[model samples]
Target: MTGVVGPGAVWLVLRATVLVVVAALLQVTVAADLEVLDGRPDLVVIAVASIAILQGPSAGAVAGFAGGFLVDSLGLGVIGSTSLTLVAVAYGVGVFGEGLRRTAAVRPLLAIGAASLAAGAGQLTLALLVGSVPQASPALALAIVPGAMLDVLLAIGLYPAVRLLLRRRGPRTVSLDLGAARV
Candidate 1:
């Protein structure tokens, strides 16, 4: 984790840890109760995507794993389920950002929106593979859109906050006009 960013390892880890923890708590306690077209906003995916955008794929993967573990342990569902889904979310967002990260505001919104669908699909696929298939219906497909919209709305606000929090602090480099300096 530290190697990915270079320097201020403690600061980065602490910030990521806090972000993940809060998101998990919010997901389980708050987000779980809220619904959007029969789906709830995925705060976990939002947090993971936000970090992945700032730190890249490796960091995002690590954060996803950690956050997933926390959520799983909280006894929401099958072990490693959320973790796996979030890992995919983090990696997908990170990879997406790798190519077009410079677009700023739009990138994070789209990344989170896309990854939200990926997370739901991944979870459903995994659940089916494990023989614990959740109820399927047309609502399931429709739910992804609102869930994605919620994620986008959340990411629109969250990505910037996370970026600001994890921003590297250092002396600003000044380009001086010393080209004509006398020896």
Candidate 2:
């Protein structure tokens, strides 16, 4: 594992904070009005997952917590519910990213999809635990799928920019390989 210290670490933290805050703002503003099949895309979740995969578990957890807290505060939901769910999702994605090769071009897209589904499930489970929802109705349960789809679609465009913003000292190269290599 590599460690960034001194001013570089500070800059990294600042950049991550800005990214999460902007995502939260967009989520509450623009993204809130755009719904697909009664499900809204979560920009905060996408941002947190993007940062986590690019950075690491610790950074991911921190970004997730910050983003979730912002969403909760802005939307007036249970204060820590989103924060808790996002923490797990971000950390999990970060760990998964760590296990992959550096040149895995499609990792961001895959990670975003998985993170979105996991975040939806976590939020639903937390809502159930908090007694916010009476029960897991079919509509509510299925809503998660559409949200995940929307998140993936958004990530398709957002991921590359995120990757670029978080890029360290390296050449920019991305390739989508569908594993069609013939031995």
Candidate 3:
């Protein structure tokens, strides 16, 4: 398979690296302190999802893993839980994003919402599996709903910025474009 090799690839890597680092840092420092109805927005999820949707699955998965690792390392919880969840969520979102028409508006928002829910559920389930949730309580509702809401809300603003940031200078073969090859 032909791939981006050289300056474009390097620039993409640099941009993605910078984005993941900044998002993770902001997540740990700024977003960690804010609470809305006992829910804290996850900027890392937003970043990963945005990247996944904009760049495609592989990029999304890498961004997810990187951002998740940084957040997990900085915060308190199971070591690989967030990373695992983010990787899966980002990849799925990326795959889903690749199918949509470029002009579609609401679909990206839907993708963000699904990604938020999946990320929240995946992490919460992992926490439960590791016996880290403490006890069966309203923590499930508190953790998923409000946080997902905040995630989608934030994505409304942030996703567009990420989309603009990741505008392709030239097309790279990130995913198959079935529509491009018409008989």
| Model 2 residue 97 distance off true place after TM-score fit, in angstroms | 0.5
**Predicted candidate 2 versus true structure: per-residue lDDT over 1-183, tens digit per residue:** 136655566667777789999999999888889988767899999999988888888889989999999999997788889999999999999999788765566777889889999999999999998898879988887889888988988898887788777766534577777689633
The list of candidate 2 runs beyond 4 A from truth reads: 169-183
Query: Which window of 10 residues has the lowest lDDT sum in candidate 2?
Result: 1-10
Against the reference, the lDDT scores of all candidates come to 0.81, 0.86, 0.82
Model 3 steric clash total: 0
- Write one digit per residue (lDDT tens) for candidate 3, span 1-183: 014465677777777788889999998889989998777898888889988887789889989888888888887655677989999999999899889765556788789888988998887778777887766667574668788888888888888888777665786556656897843
Off by over 4 Å in 3: 1-6, 171-183
* lDDT-superior candidate, 1 or 3: 3
Model 1 residue 71 lDDT score: 79
lDDT per residue as tens, model 1, 1-183: 634444677778898999999998888888888996656898888888888877788888888988888878874677788889888789878877777654488877888888888887887778777878666667666767788888888787887888888777766777667679733
